[model samples]
Target chain A: MTSTPMTARRIRNGLKIPLMLAPALGLVVVLFGGGILVGLGQSLGYFPAIGLNEFTFSNYTTVLTDRNFLISLWLTFRIAAVTTVLSSVLAIAFTLVLREKFAGSKITTFLFQVPLPVPHLVAASGIILLITQSGLIARIATAVGLMDTPADFPALVFDKGGVAIILTFLWKEVPFVGLVILAILQSVGPQYEEQARTLGANARQRFRHVLLPLIMPGVMSTSIIIFAFTFANYEIPLLLGVRFPSTLPVVAFREYQDPDLALRPQAMAISIVLAVVAILLLIAYRRLARSAVK
Target chain B: MTAVSLRHISRRFGDHVAVRDLNLDIESGEMVAFLGPSGCGKTTTLRMITGLIEPSSGDILFDGESVLSTPTERRGAVMVFQKHLLFPTMNVAQNVGFGLKMARVSREETAERVKEILELVDLPGLEDRKAHELSGGQQQRVALARALIVRPKVLLLDEPLANLDANLRITMRHLIRSIQKEMGITAIFVTHDQEEAVMLADRVALMFDGVLQQVGAPDEFFRTPRTTGVARFFRNGNFLRGHRRGSTIHTDVGPIEIVSTSETVEDGPSVLTVRPEEVRLVNEETDQENVVPAVVTSLIYMGSHTQLTVTIGDTPWQIQAPAAFQARNGDTVRLLLPRGHVSIVADDDTATTGSAEATLAEGSAVL
Candidate 1:
């Protein structure tokens, strides 16, 4: 017990902050960071589990040159773009209503926040039950004489446009973004709006100049988070997208489960490309936000 | 510029009356100060003029036309608040030019006018600085420039200098008075500092307990007070309880001469008010109308003047004398209470005493 351990004492005294942070740092460095490194290695065609030991760029070359991959990329971009734009715009409108002092507004605000804790996969299943071709709405329409048969109902899920997937995301995400903007609106509440009204600004001008600019940081932050999450999510699109030209996540996940082991490196290559593109888009948005706030 | 008028204006919040039936006619191109203690309805009246707070029953007219139903933006009346609420996201130039931007003025003209206004407020070359980047005084100057840039017909200032330090408060008072006069803009300001009202306004309107007590020029408040409450508010603290017979007040301190006008009854129980500064310290009882022999009881040394409390018979009187005067406690002295400075007024015991105590309690808390 009297013998000194120099490195442990040094860590306790001199590197106190790093020692305390080791637990969180360990998970990030060992799990996600290590996983990314492994993916990067295998993405160059070095999958040791299947006994292929040579590293090559052939996997990336194969995926990048595929016409089907290009079609999938465009389709995924449109879905994420439409969902995020609609969620953000509708969220601001919802926040404006929530800020009013009408009857039952407090209960309504509480109800709006209820979807925040729900899982995205659960929301997709709910969408399937309600709006798909043979789902509740279609059966009700058939009964109501609006449709002659279940097949006569429009195909919302597993369709080329991916309407059901976007609807699912909107159902969950509008509240998420609305609650963020609502917090900002409540904190700085109407002080600048009152001043603007006295300065000859009409209702529309007050919202455009004062309220919108004041709450922009919150809106931009939530929208970017939603875009990144929806871009990389594989479950909803796989369950609700077309078989041909599926999104990048679903296509990569399909390759991951294939019986042929040679396709393992292709899955890793596609995932690495997806992560890099999401980061690049986020960087562009950060630049846009800086200029807009100024 | 516009002449503003409030006719029979009153506002009630539930059971609490904020501003009672008030009528005031403000001339065109004049500056007026709504002055009172806290909870005195001055600010409520000011906000009513701006149409931000509606009166329960009244007609507010601008340039002889009813503006009670007109929207705040269309009324051409802008308010400068105590907090100097510059938009946090905008730069100095953008904040100053906000009114012009709303009016759809050309960008070049807005920029040019913003620059001119910044110079007028003595804060030039600060166009790009954000609100947090400037000092408090500079931010307030920008607030003034923002309100002035639109050439609004009526300017409403709600305690605009109440948030500043003592020295800056004086500086801003002069700046506001000069700007209001030079631009020939009809302006109304609300403040609790009587000195500020007296210094910056063409006329002072004093309120108490949700009711307007008096409105006149600054000197009129001192010479011709309408009631005892007005006298005590301005700290004209020499009140002698007496019985009035014709023009003289008979009290324990002998007959105090007064120049009673039409404001008081000819023969009745009364109270007389004389300002402390009007009383004089003398070596002997010269031929003065209200000279009295008294013994000094207490004295407080205020720099320019010394307040001496003296007892005549069994009653005490507060009077101010020169700072260098030699006087001690229990010293016999001859005091001259001037005749022309005395006024007989209605007793303030009839006014709400409970509200008066509440006002004093709040004032002490603020101090």
Candidate 2:
């Protein structure tokens, strides 16, 4: 299928538009659509490489019955719940405190929004550098006689407590939530607030009645996304999470990377669990979006 | 007791003066309009009284208490905005009951008060409907209901009808006036529309360039405008330049009688002002002096009346006459200018010449 120059030119120009769109469309299909299908198929135990020819419920039974899997799932839920609640409250408070114009409003707004575009791995590492006990602060403390030695520095990350992971997520997610809410708040013009003030609403009353309801949908939507991301997120958990019976994503990643090919089906089973939770979060997000009339 | 008063009030926005040295006294229950063009500080003045914007200097006293330092919520004022600022999330009842709920009125009282105010604004059974579900006019009614349910000492209306269509605006203007009168609340309406101001306000205060040009009853403001700025806002007024000669004034259009409240000063060229309605359209047989023979160049049919554009001695003038009047485009007619309706004004350009044009400048001269 060759063509004449005139026909070739038309064909070339016509193909260019779809060709330019092909990469993004292919990424969406392969990364999102194909990944879900593959994960679903493997979860049912149809993998030829593992010598499992028929679809079986063994992987799912294993996922549901394992005590370690249950603990990891529970821990992930706790971390996500804490992170979402703390991030939403902190984000809204931070936005309200710096919403009005002041000397540092623009800089503060930019600083809060800047963390949103940064990758999760980068944000996790940044938090680790500051908050980890054996990090820079611990070295300074040891040198300044505040601590006797480096080992005396208390544990913040790399422990089963999961507080460090929650804090890391909050440090990243609170600002992201703030930025999303600030965009909505900027459009919620001061006219409504001013009108409320004249109608005898104090500052707290204005925020509670007028401002909060207007930005609630944005906050809820952002919370759902953050919850989904933190629940199945591999990087933050892998980098800072505990080794034994860690968060769901970290445990699932370890099983997937194991040398035993038989264990890969169980990893797919865990991925399937993550996918279900993420999908439910997505559904909750859609409901929140629909409810965001104001 | 006066309802609202501003003494030596001025507001500046980073060197740009929005309102300057304004002293106004509004009696209790009086509806006054601050009418002017955009950027004339009418809305700014209203907001200052409502405490939405603080004045740079001077004081705002509401019911004899200085509210200058008070926050907007504590000022005992409520303002209805230009657009429907109803809470989209809340239903009509909740939005109306917001202030009461904020003031911590009991839930039972809030519900009863919301019901009563909704009925007062003629939205009797719309307590459960969302604000977005209502029409523009209905939304405005809800906003009014919301404002009045709180029972503030004063109500401020910032061009409340500016967002509605023409017919709705006219209907709402009457409805708002009736509501204000019924509530007997001191309302300060801010508008750039002269017709809206005239129809809604018991007294219209004309403002120009952030300065109050005249404040009086609507009839008085129209009858004798303190300045050309005020006269220009109402409609076409015939401006004839002339110099006073003792008891009478002589001009290019001819001479008319002069009875001034001010004492006689140096005689100079002055402007005599007469509205279009004051110019009588006489038939050929009518005996009237100072009749100018003119040709009607254009005719505008305005429903009940026809506006005639006539050229009288090289100067164009508009004459508003009833639609039943016998007049046509390009018709030659005699228009009489009587001495009773005309007032004199000095040339503001020569005002710096130390009353050089003050002799004939009588009848509320503005210099």
True contacts kept of each: 0.68, 0.93
Residue-level error in angstroms, candidate 2, position A220:
0.9
Query: What's chain A's TM-score in each predicted model?
Result: 0.92, 0.82
What tier of docking accuracy does candidate 1 attain?
medium
Query: For this target, which candidate reaches the highest DockQ against the unseen true structure?
Result: 2
Residues B1-367 of candidate 1 have per-residue lDDT tens digits of: 9999999999999999999999999999988999999999998898888788899998999999999889988888998987898999899999999999999999999999999999989998999999999888898999999999999889999899988999998998899888888999999999999999999999999999789999999999888787888988888766666667788887666788877676547575667777788888777737766877888999888999888898777667788888877788999998777888888766676455767745643453343
What DockQ values do the models have? 0.68, 0.74
**In angstroms, how far off is B7's CA in candidate 2?**
0.7
Which residue pairs show backbone clashes in model 1? none
What value does DockQ give for candidate 1?
Answer: 0.68
Could you tally the backbone clashes for each prediction? 0, 0
Off by over 4 Å in 1: A1-23, A134-153, A239-245, B262-266, B281-288, B291-298, B309-318, B324-335, B353-367
* lDDT string, candidate 2, B1-367, tens digits: 1388889989999989999899888999999999999999998998888888889998988877898889899888889999879998899989999999889999999999999988877789999999989999999999999999888788889899988999988888888888888878888889999888888898888888788888988887666776665777788556766666664667555566656547664565566677888888888987666666788888888888888888866667888877877666678998777767777654444454556545435432332
TM-score of each: 0.89, 0.87
